[model samples]
Target: MPFFKKKEPKKTKEQLEKEEEDKKAEEEKKILENEKQIEVAYRFLMQPEVQKFSDINKRVFLRKRGLTTDQIDQAFKRRDEKKESAQTGTEQQQITQQEQKASEENKSVLVYSETLEQKLATALKNGFLSIQKSNTTELSPKIFEVSNLKTLVASQNMLKEIPDAIGNLVNLRVVQLAECGLTNDVISDKLFSLPNLVELNLSKNKLTSIHLIVNLPELQRLDISYNNIVELPEDIEKCQKLQLMNIQNNYINFFPHNFTKLVNLKRILISGNQFEKEAEDALKSTGVEGLFKFLSQ
Candidate 1:
């Protein structure tokens, strides 16, 4: 009984109130930490470093980290919508079939790009920009490090205009802009003018007219299928270095009468387009085994 009486006294009301306030603040801090963790999980989903995970695993990880299935799907969809919107320039494919004005057969022509953002992220890591996230449209005009960047595969993306900044990629050998809804034909013209460009793939775009391989000193192959192209310009007769040309499934109604001038012109792929007169003088110089196997088919 004597030892109990010698124990310390109980805390006062003022001290008790202060301790309560401290406890509340600690709880709030914990809540903030949880929110930060959620953001981390979402960023991991978008990063390339975490892209190897399977789709099901990704969803499971997201759900476990407090993201709903609907929210996760929405996160993945943000980039796709940007590309589709840009494609709207000429042959834009609606995200859903209900938005389509054309029939199912015509709709097949539209290519859906699901990896434009991922590709951009890779480009950034390769010296394009530090794009953590930004407007999905309106590609930045910042200089990209293209040292020997031979193949620029941005096909099926929502790319409308290539900034004049593209001229910096002097060592480009192959450029694939197929089905990206690229309308700025000027970009293609600029691309053709690149001194080092050897192979070009501009298939399934929305071009109405074009200047073909007339004077590309090093150009060896060209593919311009599935567009609104009417005819190849007669100036193509001047490109003596061209070895292969693919003009498949387009709106060509006439063959250039000056075609015979390209003595160095090789394998010509005029299939998939309506040919009124089979030019008896087909290109004979194209290495049948090397340049245009797709055109031959």
Candidate 2:
């Protein structure tokens, strides 16, 4: 018996036209975005703040200003050529000096950045911020005695999860993982193992719960802002040294019951959450102290 293969459904002319129109619209949107970025690059190149930075920092500043590497190079090249033209009659030896002087004078400058990942690699080699991933199939569990490491930032990567072995870096003081698409389930609970973690920023992630962080003894600053958090750990007061906590723009409806006990808190950015009307009104009127007092009652 012969078996017949299923035929694929063909798209209609109208559907094809619609797809083309959608593609064109998307391309136009991207072009507009690029044009805006180019304008921003030009403005950023003219900023007085850009004048003080070294070549590497200039590249970083450009990247932060939303300019693509290609745009940055093009801008820098144009600025350099303009300088070369201005000093046409200068001696060849003086030409180099003139170029250097003009390059420093203008707001435009450029140098290559390998990638954020590559920058992280250099930071790792220097023994402060380490990035260790082997392949897509499996991650390497190589632990480091990075006792003196002050900060570890792993942001805007395809990282599904941080390895459990990160806890081995016991002396880590600050950890930033903003905009990494991390969820609570993906992150290892061993993060709390870092006893010396004074600052922890997990902003712009998909975290639904972060009660595990309350165990960090020396945590002074916690930024779980812009997440899916609805409540904090009841024992949040355990972080006796916490001086600042930024939980703004989350799903939190109320402050923790023992929140008042955190007398060390100097700043608590809890706006843009699902707070109750009475509490929110009190907070909006009298501030954090009022909010704490209302919660305490």
Candidate 3:
């Protein structure tokens, strides 16, 4: 016999294709992992403390952590790209906002061209009214003529009272009376009687209490912060749709007995108040839900 070795069997087409597919899959997986590594390196290098490091020191630090020079360069490249993208987005947003503001100013000049009261009436017809920082001491009774008013803003005024005429705006949804120097006695009970009221902001005032004589079925946001409130009304839980309540810097020591009934409540700011140490600690650590749970027990 001749001294010839037998040839090994060749791989079939299917077997070769399977091997190629597996090799490609593995290469894709490695590329994905490398991208993830680059992302992690980018985030790590962008940390406030790490950003203080010199460029040379940053590379040395990453190298000691098993990152190659190529990965560090990619991370820096990604960071620069993200920064450029963010700057571009911010510039675009600013430009859009400026254009919109200019448009609004032009509209105001063209449409609201009469006396202040007439301008407010025009805005009310458009379902919006704002009388901010105009030395407004009181709301003109003429404003309440618009029954379909949806939003009302009277912020930063010298107004001392909310007239009962506000209740005539049956379709009112939002009311902002912030920084109006209102006292508890000056707040008309009808202010809480609006059927469609959703948001109410009476912040930076001297109100001592929130007396909910009627259920506000649509009320969602209530901001009474920076006020002199002593305690919340037990009927506050009747606002089944209430989501956010800002009662910070009040004198509240305990929650209303039925407060736990507010299942829809999402956030409640109770800081700068007089809650007991245990209650305060619970709120500080576990937030509104935990505080409510603690109070319920």
Candidate 4:
């Protein structure tokens, strides 16, 4: 008997495509598996908690694990709320306990709109925190300890000067003062020295320039829209970590150089500037060619 003819090798275009797709899928799967393994190994570093409070009512116990104070506080905060909600007459007790905790820790917690000044005064009198925000015009320049505070939001207020004391919040990560009355003359040198600051929102203010906040090392997102910013600082190239900048509705007459220093910039809104022809042409040549709508409109 003649040897059985080998099965005809089938290699159609569809089959080739299928093979390539299968290879890609396999590669992606491997990559995903590796990523998952890496994530599992390092998750502890992402959300460190100082302690795991299983039951605060029983006794204050801290978990001897890799955790930070922030993580621990966050984890227990929700648990405390749930526990209090489940028990009657616990709200009053919680208030007393919170006051005691704040006193002992020498921490500040102020979140009441009913006579803010009065409430802050009481907290300050209790020595829990140094208070600020006495008025819509002036922020206390001696409140935050130049090494503490994590967040500061004083938006929708009428103010022209950002207190030099603001630099005291060296650990600040998020600061939102949008719609505040600010001008180019009201620059604060201390504000630029904040090391941990990441998000800054100064939109809808009377800003006339960008140099005011051009060199924050860790600043990631900046919102300066609705201001009178006509130009950016030449030293803006130094803000290496800046990721997003919104400079809409300003009278930008020229393009700032080294727009390339914004290596991580993913979105830029310049849709309301009065650009000269040369400036407009410059923007179009750069990858930001789409910002022409400002001039067209």
Candidate 5:
């Protein structure tokens, strides 16, 4: 006798339709739940008590309440949209007036909390400011208020870009932004236009080229070591007062012939760069002076 094979029962058309309806219902429920969460997060963020918290702290608060980063961001986006939608022309003028008043108030403050504003305030008062390893990503516009700043050392920070407002500090004599994660594009040409800048150190950065060294009649010492520079600007000869330079550990193959015009240059460091055999030998045998003489001849 042959055995009969068992066959599974198939669902009715109505049953299949019911399953699809259940899936659609579940998706709608999830969407509603997400919208509710976003609404709650936005309300919590806009509460009078929560309004005083920083944006970073506000995100932390939402995360603590079990909202994911995407949910928190969505809530903030909604809040910003609402704000923009509700803002009238009168409100805009009021906000602008308030900002102007705040700017004026900032100039008179002598002491500030440990923020970039504090650094600018200190620079305003003392003409020198140094901020290192502070995780600073950007400079505050308040920096422009510190017009009397003479020395600014913001090394070892996370500032990948330098703002053009820094050029307003025309009194700057020393600027050291080494290890600040700078690139070629972020450097301002107005930085090179500082008439009083004497010492500039941009070492250990990711720069490929720097702006022309022009209008810096008082510039003396320059350091741009440990970068990806392929060539130096020919206008570097304009820094007639340059006394010392350090361009070590870069991709440079040769110096511009105009480099020989730097009559005041006394010391230079050119190691760990790509130079021709004769230039390398000259530098090894007789130092930067011999290399300069050889390149000149």
Candidate 6:
């Protein structure tokens, strides 16, 4: 009898290719993970507080976290490039939207020619009274006249100004216009004419002044963050009913000299601005009441 050794079966080409594909997918996932880490590191380093550190200290700190100088530099470069592309894309989109809006405004002449209440009902039905995401198609002019409209959320629109007709909505209670791309001089003073306006949010706009909303006696909450405001509006304390106010992330160098007059304010955020050391310390203390106490002194 002849002794025969069993032969091992070889893997087919298809099997080898599948293994290679799996390995490549895993490597890509890992690369993406590293890229996310680099983005987080970039944001951390770019903070105003972190930037106060010396360059040598920054390098030491980053190295301790396992990041290299080359990686940081590359991250910044990529961020700048992305910003440039995004800005370009935004400009193009804005131009296209403006043209589209103009065309729709002409059609709206017919759509909005009905009675004011009918127009208001139609606009509300067509998504005119809310904060719409960018994925929503073809934003039309959201003009309407409903006396009973209690809440209006018109955020993330390309509005250069709030229309004057909004003043007719006397029963409006809550109005949110965050990220509406409003300019300093764009908003008409008519917006402040709403007799029952209670909550107003204008965060993440381009407003350089806020004098219009100073006398809203029933305003309970007001958010005006991430704007270009250099100073608080005069007579802001006249909003005697205000409870919460957020004016963070602006260019304000100091709190209003008479900030203590706002005694009814329960919460106030003034971070990410150019505050003096004393003011900053006061804010960093126990709470909003402590900041008010410090301002009083």
Q: What is the lDDT of candidate 3?
A: 0.77
lDDT of 5 by residue, 1-297 (tens): 989888779999999999999999999999999999999998876765344335654564466568877787788888878777542112334434544564586632212222454355456668988866665567656666678999988889778578788889999999999998888788788788887999999999999986466568898999999999998887778888999989999999888878888889888888889888898788778876888879977
Task: Give a tens-digit lDDT track for model 2, residues 1-297.
Answer: 999999989999999999999999999999888767766665655555344334454555566566777776656655556456432222334434544664686423222122333343444456465332221212223224444556876655446777787778777888887777788888877788798899999998899998898779899999999999999888888888989989999999876778788888877887889888888787777877887878877
lDDT of each: 0.58, 0.69, 0.77, 0.60, 0.77, 0.68
Candidate 3 residue-wise lDDT, 49-154, digit = tens:
3443345445544654677667877887787686674321123344345446645765342122223544454564488888776666678776787677899888
Per-residue error at 204 for model 6, in Å?
0.8
Q: Tell me the TM-score of model 5.
A: 0.60
Model 6 weakest 10-residue run by lDDT: 109-118
Range of the 10 consecutive residues with the lowest summed lDDT in candidate 4: 50-59
Q: Give the runs in model 6 whose Cα sits over 4 Å from its true position.
A: 1-128, 134-143
Q: Residue 160 in model 3: shift from native, Å?
A: 3.0
Off by over 4 Å in 1: 1-143, 184-189, 212-215, 280-297
User: What does each candidate score in C-alpha RMSD?
Assistant: 14.9, 20.5, 21.1, 21.2, 15.3, 20.6
lDDT of 1 by residue, 1-297 (tens): 345556677999999999999999999998777656555655666666445434444554455456645455654455346335321111112223322432364432222112333444455456332222222333443323435455676666556676666667777777766776766454645566778788778788888776745546777788888887888977776666777788888888666666556566657676666664333223233343332332333
Candidate 2, residue 147: the lDDT equals 43
Better structure of 3 and 6 per lDDT: 3
Worst 10 residues of 1 by lDDT: 86-95
Candidate 4 Cα outliers beyond 4 Å, as residue runs = 1-135, 276-297
